[model samples]
Target: MSTLPLLGAAMTVAELEGLQDFILSRDRDLELQDFCELGALDADWKPAAERAKALLQGYKGRLGIHGPFWGFTIASGDVEIQKVVTRRMRQGLEICDFLGATQMVIHSPYLTWDYNNLDNHPGRKAYQNFLDYTHATLDPVIAYAEKIGVTMVVENIMDKDPDIRRILVEDFNTKALAVSIDTGHAHYAHGSTGAPPVDYFVRRAGNSLQHIHLQDADGYADRHWNIGEGNISWAAVFRALGELTSNPRLILELRNKSGILPSVDWLKARGLAE
Candidate 1:
């Protein structure tokens, strides 16, 4: 297998230094996943912005960006919600430009409101309507991303079906729009014995897998377990990746509150991070 690139989910500026330390001081393979604070846009966020930029410039590692999931709803049918989503998406893309982020990760809007519980689910007509609205709302944002040379990666969420990824990639009809497969979310939705039939997904996605968020989980729930702590077979996954020859950005989107460095260390000890 080709060398798999590693990355840390830098949800805060403080985490970037740790990532730098891991890659440089420890000789570990890693990159940085920038998780920008959308709420800080109105605040004096320039310092964080500068720090993020510095990490991108100094770290000698590939960069990826995760957009704010709480406030942004790119698929909202409501006009007001759509406006907010567009504004936030534009802001996030601008941040990506500054950070030189190759991919911008986005969460599909949660099922809310009256028709919210009905988006391409159960394969019904109402769900199809919801899908149409979502595609309509996201086209402008996708165009904007293309103009700036950024790939917009819509992620899978809890209770989301696997087919949605295929639907989005096929319907969007743009390289700028792609999928950020979140292993944790997929495990939460599917049984967590292993990945969500990733071999099938990889084939279905073809070249649309722009990025990946790797975390482990048990069949019971999505625990964001470190690389070796859960039922996942990293070696097997890497084996598939080798066959596919699609080395999408592999970001370690684990629970950083604890177990983050230990996970890196575990991979290092096994020569997985070399």
Candidate 2:
């Protein structure tokens, strides 16, 4: 048995309802993104949380959760919005505790639109303000996550370069704070922002790279196709990953359940995963 970094796929609660055998048979870990949405957080999250716990009843492998991000901005200029984001994320951490999830993925709020507008304001001052605001909003959540022993991995969503995320993770300077690189997002950033190739994210985050959403994309949209269905250089990307000293969780984040096994088979055939 090869002890390669745990390979898995993202799944919703609905998707896993009747597909436990199909999912657990192929992957060693599950990145639960369904419970991270706003609607699921309503009603004290009781119903959803109970369902999630039931779903993982007998599975022994690791579990991860993607934190609530849609319509929420952790680094927003609006104070009320920041409050809502923190509240929802704290709920996410609570869910992590209930599910025994050691890692949780939070999407980075950094956006190219904000970066572009920075020039109109002042020298790096605007960017610095954004970082400060983000830290202030997430500091308490990060503290709680640390206390609960959950690694809060921030995933790159709209970052033009890895520097912004690297800075955010390094500023916290804690084992609990790390980066989650999404291959499809990196490819999109490369095309949209002229950022470095997808592998650069791995190299830049290095040991701090704690999680990965491995998916293929056509450099234009977040297609989330099967591993070999897009143009990303998997060999180069995996080569960079192989150099990392940290054993990051590699979760194939295909958009559809149908693409999961094919993605797994693609990697297994190339000896990239066990």
lDDT of 1 at 96: 72
TM-score of each: 0.79, 0.91
What's the lDDT for residue 197 in model 1?
Answer: 52
Q: Model 2, which residues run further than 4 Å from truth?
A: 22-27, 117-123
Model 1 regions lying over 4 Å from their true place: 1-9, 23-38, 58-60, 110-124, 192-203, 265-274
Model 1 TM-score (2 dp): 0.79
Worst 10-residue lDDT window, candidate 1:
26-35
lDDT of 2 by residue, 21-105 (tens): 7656754778888777668787566666678778777787778888888877778878888788888879889999987888889
Alpha carbon lDDT at 219, candidate 2: 88
Return the top candidate by TM-score.
2
Whole-model lDDT per candidate: 0.63, 0.83
